[model samples]
Target: MALLYIIIIVAFIDTFSQLPIIAPFAISLGATPMLVGIIIGLYSFSNIIGNIVSGYWIDRSGPKIVLCVGMIFVGIVLFFYSIVTTPQQLVYVRFFHGLAGGLIVPAAFTYLGSRKTSESKGRIMAFSGASVGIAAIAGPALGAIISGRFGYDYLFFMLTVLMIGCAVLAIFFVKELQVISSKAASPQITSLKLTKPMLFSYTSIFLLMFTLGILTFALPLKVEELQLSAELTGPLLSVFGLVAILIFVLPTNVLFDKWNNVHLMTIGLVIICGALVSLSLSASFIHLLLAMMIYGGGFAFIFPSTSATVVEHSGEAKRGKAFGLFYACFSFGVITGSFFAGALAVSPSFLFLIGALCLLLIVILLYLFSWKPVI
Candidate 1:
């Protein structure tokens, strides 16, 4: 439990802290507004590739080695972020960062999701969800403060320190999940096709993460456009996290064990669409806060349900691949959102509207394809 919690903080701070600046830093390096997304996109793109490879490795070798190596690798690469002088260099470095850095998270999560029994899985996953909320509550604001006081380079330096600490934790404190011995023995994976629920898990998480990319990348720039203080963005962004803990994560943890998930997930999807529209329309700090709060609530419902879907559907033998593919969708959504959000930054509403429309389409597809329409 302590190991999982520690990794959660390390992952959250490490991820969210650097995300807000990836685009701005590229622009600072003489990349045009249009090109800023490329650097961020490259990271997600390479991260997608990393997910596939890391998934394979996690299944075979277990997550401990993968997590430690990825943390150390990313910590070292982030040091290079401080010295890069050009957009091209930043892009290359970010791609490498994603390729190697990608190994840590899915590996950590895969182990956690598969570590426990069916009856207690929700409890474990709830703890995981709550940790994300806690991190979001603190990480972004702390990141903004750090950047404001020291500069982005200093933020990177601090992140290196954090990742190294996480590596140390992985080495001495973290306990490895028991491998499914038969699954571990099989080296030949025939395909990556998922069952219906798992497919829904992948798609749902992808859409959710897509908005995260847009929200994370676009909102800071939006804050800048509104002539708001950059520091304000962190708290405004963290609003969603706060709401998630209250309305989504904790409640879902209890309900996940007993509830019919389809209705809950649909409601979450609706809330997410509303959040996109609200965020698109927002012009004031208060409005941004409201938008984020809605987004966070939707996340609270969607993530736990989706995680349960994955855990319930996946075989112990294939859990690593299952989670790996799940995160691959995560990277794709982030890449798509970051790149397109940059292109659409001229009018943020368009991105939000597009997101809402995509969700509507996905909802329809989910309804049509659902193998069991119980809810």
Candidate 2:
């Protein structure tokens, strides 16, 4: 279990590390703003494929193999990042990278979900979110520092080594569970079904990460506009993670179990909307930091809630597919947000405002549709 968390952390670290550098790296390769956005989005777009496919594989073969192979493929892709010279090549790299990465989280989450009892699901998932929060804290700062001091190539090489090492750890230390089988599970094909809880969970995750995509796409540009060095982007992002991690580990985490997931999601979305609006209005570094803190609070609320909802609703046999589809929504949201931000070529303020509105729309629909399920 500890090793599983470590793998999750490393996989996410590989992701968040690129947040600060991705824009600048593409620009260095002569990518236009639009092209940079496409380059960023293409990864998530292809990741949808990987996420869906991985579910079937995880159900059949088990998560250990998926994690190990995914890590190796991702490491190989990161190595290509060091050698790519053109934005087009970077696009190819990001697409494959997203695909490779798409395999990992579903595998880890499915592993956890299969084993977790109902009473412990929310708390345990909060810990999983905390692992992600830790990565969010470390990844950006390390990315900026390494890229700032040693250059992006070296940073990519370092990530490649770290991923490969984690893969080795997965192979040796990660335990393989006996894959649970039932009449429903023995068939290789698991029919993907959409239920109310799944719908709520999927919608919430999409909106949450969609806003994040916009933020990630816009933040570096926002820093540049404010005449701040790109290094500041790391700390700004870290603030969000720091706040989120506190909420995840502190006593507040218990709310995930005690509270109604939909109600909690509504409250969280309201906070996130406010935070996004505040982000659009931010004028200084301190203001940006405060907005990110608010965003993190909202994030901590929703992440555990939605993840627990998925586990609580889905049966063990279909858990892999449920998570796979759940994360596919995750990738799709990022793709839409990135493309929208880039294609519009709007001010960061406008992008943030749009994100706020989108989230507000979801919140409204949630209430109107009775997002809560009947027992």
Candidate 3:
């Protein structure tokens, strides 16, 4: 279990450290606008593929093996990143990188879901999420420093080293899931019959990532609009992840356990709309800071709870595919949200206003439809 924690932390840090460099590096290689988009976006496309396949594979191959193989594969691909001489080659490399890395979440969550009781799933999920939050906060900053000091190639090499450490932890410490010998008791994984709650959980994932992806696209422009130092965006950006971590680290774990997940998610949606509305109207650093912090709180609330909902609502054999779909929604959300923000961002405030209104509409629909589940 502790090994799982270490693996999650190291894997996330390694994965995220590569984020900020992708587009700039592609552009540096004379990649055109569309090709650059392909270079950057192809990773998530391949990731969606990875998520869907790994769901089936996780059950057949085993989580420990799948996770280790995925980690090692991505680590190895990072080495290839250093040697790419053309945008096409980098594109090929990133495509595979996404495939390999995508194995982690579905497999890890499935493995955890099988092992942890419903009562305790909240704590474990929150712990894992907090690790991710810390990594997200550190990854871009660390990526910049490492790339600056040594070069982008060297940074990839360092991530490879960390990934190798993750694989080692997986091999030496992570326990394999216990297999059920009674085949009759093990229900066959049917067609992906998504239910109402599961469907909502997936949508919740998409919405969560939409907020994050658009923030990346829109927040920097907002910072520039306010005439603040570009450096201030770092703290502004970090507050979201930091607040999520704080909420998870605090007693909200009880709410995650005791509350209706759908209700928690609805509250989170409302708060995120507030964050976006604040960003849409922000005229100063303090205003943006408040919005970012609010966004963080909302993110903290939704992520773990919805994740638990997806897993909790799934049957054992169906869990892999369920989580696969859940994460794929996340990837799709990010991809679309980023493109949406990029396209509509001639006026950053207006872009955020549009995003906020879209979310408000969703909240209204959810309330009206009851999503059939809860508040």
Candidate 4:
């Protein structure tokens, strides 16, 4: 459990550590606003590719090995980030970083979700979720402080050390579970049955992550455009992370245990739509705060519900493949959201409205699907 927590924290840190630095880094490289968007968007694009491939690898190799390799890759790539002097070079690094990240998370979640009992599964996942939340809150602050004090080079060095530490911890402490051999083995571990529930869960994950990508990519840029200090951006993001942690750690599980996963997920989707609408209209700090709260709540509710449902419907032997597919959906959505939102951000008002429209479309789709019985 301790090792798992370490891995989750490292993954979260790796994912978010760049948020506060991206704008400044791009400007230093002589990038225009659109180029900055491309750098950020490219990370998600590469992440999707990595998630699909790594998901398959996880099913074949098991979580422990894949996770360790992922950590090593992240550590090495991040060390190179500080030295890159061109936007194109940064884009390349971000792509590979996303690929490494793709390996770590889905494998970790697959291992946790495949535990013997649902109750235990929920608890483990909740803890993992909380770890991510804490990292989201802390990583930006750490990045801002490091960047402000020593520069981006030193920040990358620190992250490299942290990633190496996570790798060492995983190697020393995480126990690898043996794959169950069965008649199902003939099809290969990477092959799994896809059912209606799995498809629905994938859709939910895609939409959920889509919303997150929009917020993560757009909000930071918005802050920079307003010339806000990194210190202020760090705290705002921390507040967003804290709210998400609260929702993920508390009410989400109760609702999941007491009600259907579908119901919980549907409600989460509705909340996300509302949050996006709020974001579209936000013109001040207070408005952004309220939007973040709503966005965070929606995120907290949807992630665990979707994850738990995927685990519920998957067989033990196919759990890794199932989760890989799930993560693929998630990464793909994030990639799509970042790319589209980045393109749209040339005009802030248009960008927010487009994001809101996308969420509204998702809400309608959720309702349409809900009206039909789950197969």
Q: State the RMSD for candidate 1.
A: 3.6
Ranking by TM-score: 3, 2, 4, 1
Q: 181, model 4: CA deviation in Å?
A: 3.8
TM-score for candidate 4, residues paired by index: 0.86
Question: What C-alpha RMSD separates each model from the true structure?
Answer: 3.6, 3.1, 2.4, 3.3
Question: Scored by Cα lDDT, where does model 3 land?
Answer: 0.82
Q: Cα deviation of 24 in candidate 3 (Å)?
A: 2.3
User: What does candidate 4's lDDT look like per residue over 268-306, in tens digits?
Assistant: 888877877776677777777787788778777777778
Model 2 gets an lDDT of: 0.86
Per-residue error for 154 in candidate 4, Å, reads 1.5
Which is the winner by lDDT between candidate 1 and candidate 2? 2
- Put down candidate 1 lDDT per residue, 1-375, tens digits, no spaces: 668667877777776676656777788889987677567667778988888888888877888898889889988998998999988888888888989877877788787876654547666666677787887777766676788788889998998898888899788888777666654454333234576767777888888888887887777777776788988877787788888877544444687667756665677888999998888888888888888888988888877777777766766666777778888898898777666676663666667778788887887788568766555
Off by over 4 Å in 2: 27-35, 85-88, 116-119, 182-192, 218-231, 283-285, 344-347, 371-375
Error of 2 at 133 (Å): 1.4
- Model 3 over residues 1-375: C-alpha lDDT tens digits? 666766777767776776777778888888888998888889888998999888878756667788888888988998898899998898899899889888877777777777754448877778778888988899988887888788888899888888877887778778888543324344443335666667667888799898888998888888998899998988898888898898888886778888888888888988999999999999999999999999988888788888888777876766777788888898899898998887773788998889999988987786556555444
Which 10-residue span in candidate 1 carries the lowest summed lDDT? 183-192
Pairs in steric clash, model 4: none
Error of 3 at 308 (Å): 0.8
For all candidates in order, the CA lDDT equals 0.77, 0.86, 0.82, 0.76
- What TM-score against the true fold does each predicted structure earn? 0.86, 0.89, 0.94, 0.86
Residue-level error in angstroms, candidate 1, position 285: 4.6
